[model samples]
Target: MGRYQCHLLCRWFFTQSLCSVIVQQRKTIDYSAKQNLLSYATESSLDHLGYMTDTPRLEAQSALTTFEFRLSTVLTGAYTIPAGTQITTGNNVIFQTDVLTEIPPGSLSGTVSGHALVPGVSGNGFLPGQINALITPLPYVASVSNLTESNSGADQEDDDNYAERIQLSPEKLSTAGPEDSYKYWTRTANQNIKDVNVYTPAAGTVEIRCLLKNGDIPSDELLEQIGNVLSATNIRPFTDHVIPKKPDKVDYDISIKYWISTDDKSRATLIQSEVNKALEEYKLWQRSVMGRDINPDEIISRFKNAGAKRLEITSPVFTVISEIQAARERNIECTYEGLEDG
Candidate 1:
């Protein structure tokens, strides 16, 4: 009986000591977290560190579009369209004129620069004819409509992106037009840009390809914005020609068949859910970075870890992605071949 009691006491003491060691290790990890690395630093720590780099988090920007005001008939004199003329898309998004403009007596319409009243991405993607409803009425103004698609609306920068820019801030100081310098400045143009590829296509020509979040291609307006940033007198080298373009996208498909062991039949439903989620995560990981190779091995590993007993992935062979190209998924097909005996 005494031996059994001692055994119990020893187990209890060991458990308590292990717990204390774990607590101490955790405390040390928290205290010694790397503040300089983007992956290890907390958001608050990154914000505080950004001051040293002069990289403040990017704020949301209003969408810019052109608004055209039409007259029912040619007026006898030039009709002035005042600034602050409110126009709506018939939805919640509103746009207002940026400056005072006049429609000449012989002209049937006049166009003025305008921006969305609300900032951020919500005001973007309106079609050319979408903003047709005039909120602030003016005399003899027959109609108002946007002449171009709304664009340039961007959300505020997230913590990870802000941290990345802070890390890349040193590259912005280069005057000789290095690749990293172009990348650093291009990213500063908009918060929506996900990946940037910079290379010299010719001796004096610099080509920049940018990809947006979720592998969306950069719009013309965004490319223009990036061009403007890189073309600034201080940013661009006198001998270099900078051109911003879209990344060349390599397309691939995914088709997978998997089976679960019969012994684990009860957990088949749960494992199937996990497999689907893993597939989605894999797709995102594959396209999140520029020049990420399309590897079936990565898919196999993720699927197997997600409780897939055995799987066959047929479509995505190992393809090397070029530095100026991105991989985009075209189709996805996942099939469960039912349970197989172990």
Candidate 2:
């Protein structure tokens, strides 16, 4: 299937409506627990009927992916970096892609990825991808070689005032698994969303990270709002399915438990509708992995540490721009590198 599936990963996600869920399936070919469907977690069914998928998902890159865009100011010498690290303006070739000195400043080029593959990179657009250090004799083109290339005459044009807009991709767990094109999504659920693994009686568990948003909502109304989200979305309503069987005291299936948060800012970080759906679609985990349960207070504490002060879970298209701009404003020294499949 294509990277995007018809499975409604997200419905109507707007302001503070962003969310990402990591789901692992639980093993349900039990001999006994299939007989007791009592607790929301304990397995009572004989087969893995209600569960979505099985297999813990790792990203296309690392568990934690970081993408940065850097731009430096040059007063005299020329500067040429990766193609994808710059911003852009209207019909103008604002940025220069050369390695000369004294950049008059117009635009810097930037790049993002389509998948594990980086598109046609003759080095015109943002050509950064997840590649490693060291190449056999690095070479830079001192002059143009293509006749079809425009601006063959603007070699000395000023380029300081304009910014080149580039797309940037990050390293991820996608390096594993087939068709594993996935990015880290933030959750924007309510205090009710949590890691229910603690509720389980066993160790083989599913790592669940639900992101939510509570930046603008009032303290008194947060839980209620979260409740609305849960009820609105039927099957994916932050719930767990149970199946049962043999010798175990009380077997837990795939469903996790809980609600975690402490304050408004921290509480703003919860899971959203689509993220939960993505976890189901990706089927990242095996059916045997169980979900952990957590309370509101604990979830809030963790988000604060992640540098999320004012949180909202909506679809932030400019998320990449923020990183690019931050690097530009602060004048950090970073190469225009991006994500690669290897």
Candidate maximizing TM-score: 1
Query: lDDT at 316 for candidate 2?
Result: 12
Over 1-342, each residue of candidate 2 has an lDDT whose tens digit, in order, gives 553643344344432253332111233434245443322222213123222222121112101111222233322433444432222222222222222222234433222221112111122222222222211121231221111111101111111100000000121223331111111111122221111111123332212222111111112122332333323333121343211111111111222222223343233334323223433332222111222121223223433343233223221112121110110111112111212222
User: Pairing residues by index, what is the TM-score of model 1?
Assistant: 0.78
TM-score per candidate: 0.78, 0.17
Instruction: Specify the poorest-scoring 10-residue window by lDDT in model 1.
Output: 35-44
Q: Count the backbone clashes (under 3 Å) in each candidate.
A: 0, 126
lDDT of each residue in 190-306, candidate 1, tens digit only: 887878888887899999998877777777767877898999989999999988998888999999899998988999999999999999999889887888999999999998898
Q: Candidate 1: which stretches are off by over 4 Å?
A: 1-44, 64-85, 97-114, 125-129, 136-152
Please report the candidate that would top lDDT against the real structure: 1
Q: Which segments of candidate 2 are over 4 A away from where they belong?
A: 1-47, 51-66, 69-106, 109-342
Candidate 1 yields a Cα-based lDDT of 0.88
